[model samples]
Target: MKICVVGGGLSGLVSALELAGTHQVDLFERKPVPGGCLGSYRIGDYWIEEYYHHCFAGDAALLDLFDALQVADRLVWLRGSTGYYVDGTIHPLTTPTEILRYPHLTLMEKARLGLLTLRSRRFDVQALDGITAKDFILDNLGSGVYSSFFEPLLKSKFGDRAGEVSAAWLISRIAIRSDRGAGGERLGYLKGGFRHFVARLEEEATRRGASIVPDTPVEEIRREGDGWVVDGKSYDAVVSTLPPQVTADLAGLDIARIPYQAPPA
Candidate 1:
């Protein structure tokens, strides 16, 4: 069967790879560069992520993906320290000693904050679904802690929409980054760049007879008779990783409205 996967991000590339050997697969990417947010920038002699990203020690699936692409040797674990800029002062928050030395919050508040960060993963996320992060922080750690610390983090991450963010989402984010060492958090990065992994995935998929088309935006898709019509070409099936609104617009279908927060600029 002929298959077409839309939006040439990691998901699209992986899908095309899985089906490449068994069927005819054609992947489409709208951008000139195909890695999406995982794409890299070459600075002088090195390549780094356009945006910043690091993998945690608990990232089993990500490690598995690296191994599958035969680039496991490039994986490097590095200590990444974190800091907070409060009231024109840079406060390094990596070490427990640093958090203790900070005078913004009382000893009790600091203890409460540490406890909250540690318990983030074990908390019942459903209970926090409807509650705003602002409310959650204020209720659990008091106004002093919220106003002095977490509020700044929320504002930096979500800007004006921080008040609308659910406690569940915020806590889940905290949980994902909980792998901390004495000095800082241990994060995994590829020695060269993640672009090597992307290139390998693309190369393997192509070697298995998949066609990856770049700079092609799938603007139209219609279910006509039995099969699907994709950008004037006929395909037996379709898989799309584009946003709901975008896919809905392309297929001329009415989809249920979902509350989506605009990303930080």
Candidate 2:
């Protein structure tokens, strides 16, 4: 079988490698290099990410993939700090002690907040989908707790749309973090940048008879008979991993309704 994979991001690269064992694979990437968001740029003598990214210990899928690729040794975990700025002051807010010491909430409010965290961890997020985080926090910890602490945090993170965020998202986020082990609470980083992992994937795919073409963007995709043609080139199968707008344009399909939001950083 012959397979054509569009985009050379992490998903596409991994897909090509997984399929190369029994199928001839061709990967196309518009950028000059692979890695997509995982790619980095130079900052003086060091490399810096365009956006902040760190992996939690519970990311077993990523850890397993790295281990299978023989690059697990490159991962390094670090104990980092988290701070909150409230009322024009920066407060250390990492541990339970710090949370208790937080001056923004009263002792009863703090206890209620802690109980809410524990309950959120144990509750099913889907059950809370109909609620908003603001309402849920206010209901559990009171309006004062919401207005004094969580509201500001949400505003700082999500800006004007903070109130629109669903309670399920908040619950899931807290639940996942609360379940992490001591080491899992820490963050992990790949040495030399994530490009190393991307390069390794590309090398493995090519070694397994996959052809990777960079700087080749697919302008069109149309179904013909039982196969697909991408940019006028025929392929037995096409797997598109482009943005929804790009996919619609390539396939010449009507644009579907999509929720619009501020561009993520």
Among the numbered candidates, top lDDT falls to: 1
Alpha-carbon runs more than 4 Å astray in model 2 = 43-47, 127-131, 179-184, 254-256, 260-265
Show pairs that collide, candidate 2. none
TM-score (C-alpha) between model 1 and the true structure: 0.89
lDDT of 1 by residue, 1-265 (tens): 9999998888898898899999999999987767776777678987787777667888888788888888989988888877888789998887778888888999999999899989998999999999999999989999999888888888888788878889999898888876675777788988788888888889999999999999999989999888899999999999987777778889997986555653221
Q: Mind giving the per-residue lDDT tens digits that candidate 2 earns over 1-265? A: 7788999988889889989989988999988877677766677866666556667777898888889888889899877677778668998777777778888779999888778777876787888888989998888779988898778878887889899888998887886666433332577888876766778999999999999999888787898899888787788998777676777878887778343353342
Instruction: State model 1's lDDT.
Output: 0.85
Provide the lowest-lDDT 10-residue window in model 2.
Answer: 256-265
lDDT of each: 0.85, 0.80
What lDDT is reached at residue 91 by model 1? 88
